[model samples]
Target chain A: MSQAPSDIDDLIDLMARLPGLGPRSARRAVLRLIQKRGKLMQPLAQAMQGVADTARECLQCGNIGSDDLCKICASEKRANGEICVVEDVADLWAMERAGVFGGRYHVLGGTLSALDAIGPEDLRIPALVRRVTEEGINEVILALNATVDGQTTAHYIADELAERCAVTSLAQGVPIGGELDYLDDGTITAALKARKGF
Target chain B: MSQAPSDIDDLIDLMARLPGLGPRSARRAVLRLIQKRGKLMQPLAQAMQGVADTARECLQCGNIGSDDLCKICASEKRANGEICVVEDVADLWAMERAGVFGGRYHVLGGTLSALDAIGPEDLRIPALVRRVTEEGINEVILALNATVDGQTTAHYIADELAERCAVTSLAQGVPIGGELDYLDDGTITAALKARKGF
Candidate 1:
């Protein structure tokens, strides 16, 4: 018996690689998309193509945008001499949804993972340092996750910018080993408001 | 302050429309793609495009495939005089993952809906009746969800196909209001094996 064409199989294969989706789920998702091609799949395809054509990383703060500088990085109002350093864009978005921090953000990409051999250079640490001096940033708030690697990265960044700017971290609302993406908007708002010096 | 670029906003807006995704999660997902443009985003874009270019519904069974007929429908070994009818591809996949049913599947795309004004003509019910008579099918197993709409559709199909073939419906394992997608493999297997005549 003949199988599905190679392209459909390829699509299912790629979808299987997504987090929380297995081969079975991938097949079902592909089938649903095919069934709703005009409404769901076509638009999804157009969006993906558009993103592929224009997507790029923000040079100043490691955020993702269509240009070299993301909207937050380019905004004059966001350049309030304060930068919130986060482990990932998800964390940055969590903070944004809370609507408490008017300052710009720096996405570190990931934590300092010794076991995985991910160092400061592998993240956006150097870019953060450059932004601190070049943009005349006065405060750097560390919003890394509460994991071991997250804390290590936070401490490293604090020590690196010790003399140049006031270094701080989000306070008590963040739980132990918590990722910012999982935090409620209220908790994030409280944490940002009660941020303390590292 | 200026907002995110139009294209980026469009992509995020489209992503937000997906099941279980909101504007905040959409933004986070989009941002992650932009950050890992080379490794993750590019491949995802290509996959989506490939599927869009090649995907089509199986002419006979309404299953998504790259060809006129899906693999299950095309397979001679699968045409064992029995066709397992399901409300959705998710239900079909649940049956496949359980690996107990040897017969092929006919995906109905959706159940009958009065509130939505959906009827037999809107679903694959006519095509299913055609398949039973044309393909010499002996049995049709209804593996639909245990919802009011699902049972209603099942009864409708059974009434329509009463003369041509023996119609059976999956038994007790599926909880009320539970979708087949949420059921465990073992439960689906047991339910399929112990299916009762309708």
Candidate 2:
């Protein structure tokens, strides 16, 4: 087998650099792209170009969008005075997918990690505090991950905004569809402590 | 949570349509792309566009290339009178990656599948015969898959080209690093029957 065409090889190399794709899967994907050049390939290229050109962080909320203010931040309907704070845009997207929260979001970019030397200034924590006061926020929901750093950041933000608004964290428990047999000791303990009347 | 921007959603939707990616992974991939716009996303988009504009099927062997004749078909050094036959361009790429066989290829595009109503005429069997007789081929290596349809196609091709040149197939046995305890009955039986003097 001779070297694949440079253009196709380049495409495969770049695609392999994506989050989940490896070399073999990238080759498969490139073949699939070549096979469907008229439909999937062209459209995907255009979409990537579009996003690369226009996508930006929401200055107010740190959510990704094409404008300075993300749609969530721009919308009056979403300014329900209740801001759900998250660790990353991916987490914010996950929350949106659940579609349970009626309020807007604040993306902190990352947690406070003293080991990594990441302080509050490194994240969007200052911006979050400013938004709480300026926007007259009534509640700040910490939807950060359950990691130690995540909890630490949540606690730090809670202390900073304790006087300004109500501070709450997502309920800790066993996940939906999770089995007790598979649950870790910490999760089991937390779920037991947070048990409610059925 | 508010609705995500349309462009970002479109990118995620297109990314999800690729093989081995689903909605969740697609979102993660898109976010990563957005984060690394200059380093990865833009280059990927350009590569996609380039491949889409230039990539085509090698008219001679059904392999993918930027020209009518794939590099393998055009290269004189690879004309070793041995043609490896495979079911798809993916299989052809797999053989190339192995870098063992020093010959050209004949991509059948797919196997002879009666259930799917595919036949010899539907595939490149006639093309293979033409290549063998016209190109003065000495051997035809049937490197098709181990599926029922793949074997059936291989036999059909052998019957078609037996009088013209020698015909052979890839050996059937346990794959490399395969554990005997995990081996299926069919693979174990085939490997036992094809045992060599090791």
Best by TM-score: 2
Docking class of 2: medium
Give one digit per residue, the lDDT tens place, for model 2 in B1-198: 224688888888888889988888888898899999999999999999999999999999999988889999999999999999999998888898898988999998898987999989889899999999999999999998998888889889999988999999999999999899998999999999999997
Residue A181 in candidate 2 has what lDDT? 97
Model 1 accuracy (lDDT, Cα) = 0.80
Candidate 1 per-residue C-alpha lDDT over B1-198 given as tens digits, one digit per residue, 9 for 90 to 100: 114567877877876665545676667667766766777777877887777777777898877677898888888999899899987766765677677888878889899999999999899899999999999999999988877899899999999999999999877677778899989897798779877899
DockQ of 1: 0.33
> What DockQ results do all the predictions give, each relative to the true complex?
0.33, 0.65
Instruction: Judge candidate 2 at residue A180 and give its lDDT.
Output: 95
Question: Each prediction's TM-score against the native?
Answer: 0.75, 0.94
- For candidate 2 chain A, which ten residues in a row score worst on lDDT? A1-10
For residue A80, give model 2's deviation from the true position in Å: 2.5
